[model samples]
Target: MENGNKRLAVLVGCNYPNTPHELNGCINDVLAMRDVLVKRFGFDHSHIELLTDAPGSLVMPTGANIKKALDQMLKKAEPGDVLFFQYSGHGTRIPSAKPGHPFRQDEAIVPCDFNLITDVDFRQLVNCLPKGASFTILSDSCHSGGLIDKEKEQIGPSSVTNDGTLQQSCSPKTIPFESILQHLTSQTNINTSDIGTHLLELFGADASHKFHLHPNELDLSESLKTDEGILLSGCQANETSADMNPMMTGGKAYGAFSNAVQMVLKDHLGSLSNKEVVLLARKSLEAGGFAQHPCLYCTDENADAPFLWQPQGSDL
Candidate 1:
């Protein structure tokens, strides 16, 4: 399974256009990631698939479209291939289906069409990969630390902060949940039909649907104990990721966590391990006056693996 193979990637970014929850920098975040993957990671331009909310784009970052893109990326995966999935968007939580989860809320990524993809959905995707193919995931959104439902955490913040929010950003002008609802409401044409659908799916959908509640029935730990997939999350499940004006570049907006990752990668040039990336990104965020901390989720052995490990591959 370790034979030489090419690289593939899927990148998604959403800025919730013309809505109350509009973010300014997600598209820019994805563009930055594309740059690093092309210039530094040895990925060919033809092999990368980008889905964003930018104008004149062929693909949009809706739930169905995102799932389809991921399926395409995984369908052709092979041994020694470098597979990557990157998301720079809003992340939220809904009521957990399991009583075992203390917070009673399951983490999800906010897509353009409001089909909210959950952690279980991502875990299912990770499970589909072959043993020798390295699948690396980077999520630059709030509450994304647990997007791969049952993945082991090697570095993270305290789970005790489970109020489904960040105390630092709970100001009167920035209530994220309220903003999310307002954005969803804007999509409804006349009646409250869209919101009703969201409520129905959140409260009444069958377990087979992707938007269903936390149906984490699989033993992801044992299944992926030695798997090569790794996740670098923007924050803990209870925190918020910031979309600040890019003071460093001073033009477009960018997610703090995404910018930090690119910064670390540029500085280290593949010398850092997965845990080192998280720690360095944490320090970078703190230095930039951000409250959220980056996190790393992988098995113990993979924690020491290179940031985006590839079989028999070396980097600059």
Candidate 2:
């Protein structure tokens, strides 16, 4: 069943092997997602870009490489096309540099090389998408709930449990600010307290534009109102997603949220709505004793929209 519209995807998983921020299951998460896209959703294999930090990987999941892949996908996007981005890695929260920023903190995904891609970067990307195009992001990482800045919250802390209790047995996939500062300090030999300055020095022009913006110029109204982007975050902004190893799952290592989504999709016969998927996944996580709550950020219309386009529809 081929949908008339084109489908493209960028999948990134950073295991950060042998590093202080190492994880046991990111690579496996994205690989499983790749299969799901191709086999279940009819996404062409050639149109999908895969990036990882696994040994001998052709393209590393560095910040520069990830941005380039996303740009390429957007360039190839036409109205009515479907685009997807999946990140299974460590996500960090940095104190907002701009004075009086509403959120007070900026959420980011950690690349293999430690160059961070912040929420603003994703907002800009969503703004660039063609009018009739749709871009769905599945971020299976900690502090990922608001990764796409200012998107409407269809399902979030208000609708779910906001108790902020973390399961003691679960391994969280977040890199602390101190760890990031230490790593960047070692790399650039600069002991500055500001993460933005360290990012500017290390990546130069390639660093996130968020770090370079003047405080007074930080208006995101346009990016806030986008109808083309949908985000399914692994956990609430204040919660940590679990990294499940074989010892915990008695099988292959993987992200608890990622595995929960896969299970929901597999158990269903027809396509589930975006909101339905999150609700079901949240249930699965709760049943498994994991504390992280999956969230969906998108418009009300998208909340009812079928997850990524149905296998037999032209809506993509």
lDDT scores of the candidates, listed in order: 0.73, 0.87
TM-score of every candidate: 0.81, 0.93
Per-residue lDDT tens digits for candidate 1, residues 1-316, read 3543878999998987786667878888889888878777677899999999887778788887898888888888876777899998888866565546656666788787766777877877788886678777899888888878778888977543222232232211122554555655665433443333554444344222443433464332345556766889998887778887544555567788888988888787545788898999887877766778788888887798776553334454
Q: For model 2, what is the alpha-carbon lDDT of residue 94?
A: 91
Error of 1 at 44 (Å): 0.7
What are the per-residue Cα lDDT tens digits for candidate 2 across 1-316? 1233899999999888987678888999999999889888988999999999999999999999999999999999988889999999999899886677656877899999889999989988999988788899999999999998889998888455444444444578899988999999998888788888899999998899788887665574487564779999999998889987766547787899999999998888687999999999998888887778899998888899888886764332
RMSD (Cα, Å) of candidate 1? 5.1
What stretches of model 1 exceed 4 Å from their correct place? 1-4, 99-103, 158-225, 246-250, 310-316
RMSD of each: 5.1, 3.0
* Positional deviation of residue 197's Cα in model 1 after best superposition, in angstroms: 6.5
